[model samples]
Target: MTHLTLSDYDISAERGFLCRYDAPDVELHGKMAAVRNVAMALPKTLVTGRLRDLMLRDLPNNVEADDIADLTDEQARMAMVHYSFLIQAYVWGEADAPALLPRALAVPMHALAERLGQQPLLPYSGYVLDNWGLFDADRPIDLDNIFMIQPFLGGQDEAWFVLVHVAIEARAGKVLAAIPTILNAIATGDTDTVRVELEGMATHWAAINALFDRMPERCDPHTYFTRVRPYIHGWKDNPALPGGLIYEGVEAFGGKPQAFRGQTGSQSSIVPTMDALMQVGHADDPLKAYLDQLHIYRPPGHRKFIDDVRTQSSLRHFVEGAGDRDLTLAYNAIIQAVADFRSRHLQYAASYIQKQGKTSAGNDPDVGTGGTPFMKYLKKHRDETKARLIDA
Candidate 1:
């Protein structure tokens, strides 16, 4: 019944989204447009908190370009971690709940997914290739999270569907400025309307990335990030972790079996150290956190797929620097996982082909003579993906 907007959250003012863009002339205007559009969409009461006044409206029109750049990239990166889980939360959990995005959505991998998906997979974490496969499809449930549903009665469909929006939003902050527009269409569940937004998201990513790249990060990444090193791995310069966002408060949801298991214990961070053999690890790896993020991304198949991610993460980390013997063993184990999945699918598809065989109205047109439907799907998808997603 109600619409979704980002102003409902406390972190609205602190969000570092626009800073990542180098819009000297447009920076302040861009910031205002982003905030006002969302703020105006919701009741003024929602956006009028003290800091919101201070943070949203009071910042100087000539806000320092440098501070914007630095703060924004950090927050933009942080946005993905929170945004990823919010999708899942909106899809599966209570709509009127507190900021689950802040608490449950703090995993590094999801942030990394945002980073890669936004930045184009070059500096990407190794886990992405094995775990994620996204086609640019938007669902009727996009923005179905706590922030939106608290006022509406969005059950699973609404909650799970929000993830489609989160994935798009994290990388394209400008689109987030247009949340009301998107949700209005999503609420209608009109295929044509949803398609318009989805196409915009694809282009918004292109334009935003282009904006960020226009200004050379005057502050070097090495220098910029070094300031964060003391905070990131618990070195204790500021007595806080990244985002001052404490993560220990998160809990494991049993329904999503793999959710946070590998992430939970550097030891349990998936199938446990004994099972996964700790192939990959860091003091603050965010594997568990990522699961919390994934929790809302796919509510219907939440447990199985998250378990898949957890299993995938642990196995990936297990033999990073392993010896020849260990490498061979680990590689074989991965090979088996791939083979088993492929074999199962192959069998299922084969059966479908067999059914088609019995129903053939005409004579068998040479079983292996021409290409099969599966082959066409695989080949077409592969070529299209390469052409569209891969940069020359």
Candidate 2:
């Protein structure tokens, strides 16, 4: 019934089931192109509001008051592009889903974004659309060159794995993309657009959380850690990875330093995505308990994240010819980072529960990026997500 094939999640297609986005069996390549076109067209649909005028006209000129206003102009522009692309992915995934031997799980995802008004975050296919193009005043950015080599666990029991990829893609395209929109639209009174965006984003968030599958068997953690982790960060040092996506660079002044993993909906609280991964291997009591437990050394609630980033920072340096001593330091730094993260998370969790009620899911997951600060932001405004779900 669904359009997924074993190939969608698994690299080997051990069950011979993955759906091809651009294969001979289907006009996926063409559809892919069409999807990009449609997603790219969405921002143009936004008519300028007085807020828009203020963002464009007032923010840049007046540097004293609401300094963030100048910053948000660019943020809103990029946010617009993100929503448009996710919607495009939704349509493409829909058309391509049933036609492929297996459905592309991302179809329903793209559909969710279409309805909600968010866009894809993994934006792997986003390169095709040139989100960077929004800022490009000179040349065109090439995105089609990027091909996906999605690796997942496949064989007889790979159903969950395949479904999981669907969730990842959906989150990337749907949920994560809407965080800024949901958070920012309140300022602009464009709650209608964001209401839709939040619902669609929630669709992806719910899907990503639903996946209880494991990564492909016999694969390497080093592969995930070394090869994959940095990819999520867009090899922050790599020239190919755009600086805009890299959160720490000169390009980002008003924002905190962050690294996004995949186009998967990491746009929101990337920390939640990290939480999802840390907990992914476990379940129920194990995950719940693990999530509840706090480490003494690491920050209040961010032990895992700090550790990962410090390790990643070391790994990045090692790639550039750092010594083993540096690598050793990296490992130690990761531990310290974890300790620090844990400390902050405690403060964050308490604050979040205070505002959103104790049982609230804290649904939006931030990926490798920092968690607590954004969690606070999302917790305060989480009602917007619910408000979006209201049927018009």
Candidate 3:
């Protein structure tokens, strides 16, 4: 077998994922540039404060759909990138409470995506898609490849912190792409096809594990714990935004004032996909519930997309069939690997949260945060299925 490298990974189709604002010609001299200028002008302590008020109050009530109708394709693309950051910093970053995004930003963003042939601007979509090539398996992953829209203080190690997420996402795309084939096989009752696809899915997950193994080489654990970890912190214990950057005049969850957490990295993105593949239910399952809550921090449409994928009921059927031991093992291993992946993240969080002199009060510090319930679910499914297979 040939050794796989980042260079061997095809990125030609992924270019569409890059943000136009990062292009050389755009520089720091556009409408979005003005937005950044305004943000930079704010006092560090009040950055979230001013942006919230501006987005809530100043946005015009009657802005038309055609507001971005005349923007050149390039201009519209830049607008998507610009509004993405603006929304993230102001509306989403206000960890105090949930804030309703004003029509001023929302309407125009919809129009911009329509023009650009892109999906609605989701937080982290731009970050992940634009910076994915940094983990090109062949080259050494480095900070030079990371794209930062806002000021971050953690230096190169911090850059590695973000890049690893991009790598995970890259691997996730492979698993996600295979979902349809796997589901289709189950729907048709094609046992052989189901086994083949399950093996393929397992291969993608193995690649994700490989990336995790590479973490030590990319950035030493000490550097990640001290320098890179700080950037992942939220506003809960932060002194700068003591009240958690209030969301003015917004009443959410029984009229409580809203304060959101600071920037968290992108581990939540994988939750829904994992839930769908593992046949985990969101209603009563603790792990699924935790992941479902995290989706609130994501863009509006993200969870919906995950839900759509979950509607396919084939994976659970195949596992429940319990006809093949090897296939059953592969399925079990995939679920176990995902659980292990979540455990790895928790380990990192435990160290980072501890070093920051903060508590994981509301957030569980334990592995999987949701009690590793999925592993138990998978184990039960595997053992029962294996028993039936042997009895036959």
| Model 1 clashing-pair count | 25
Candidate 2 TM-score to native: 0.22
TM-score of candidate 3 against the unseen true structure: 0.60
- Candidate 2: how many backbone clashes? 52
The number of the candidate with the highest TM-score is 3
Decreasing lDDT order of the candidates: 3, 2, 1
Better of 1 and 2 by TM-score: 1
Candidate 1 local lDDT, residue 156: 36
- Worst lDDT run of 10 residues, candidate 2, spans 94-103
Task: Mark the regions of model 1 whose C-alpha exceeds 4 Å error after superposition.
Answer: 10-173, 212-216, 225-228, 231-392
Which segments of candidate 3 are over 4 A away from where they belong?
A: 1-29, 37-122, 126-151, 218-244, 247-257, 281-290, 355-392
Task: Judging by lDDT, tell me the better candidate of 1 and 3.
Answer: 3
* lDDT preference between candidates 1 and 2, better one: 2
Best by lDDT: 3
> For residues 25-72, what per-residue lDDT tens digits would candidate 3 score against the true structure?
444344445644543432342334445675545334444456567665
lDDT of 1 by residue, 103-155 (tens): 22333323334333431011111111111222322421113221221111223
- The models' CA-based lDDT, in order, is 0.27, 0.28, 0.48
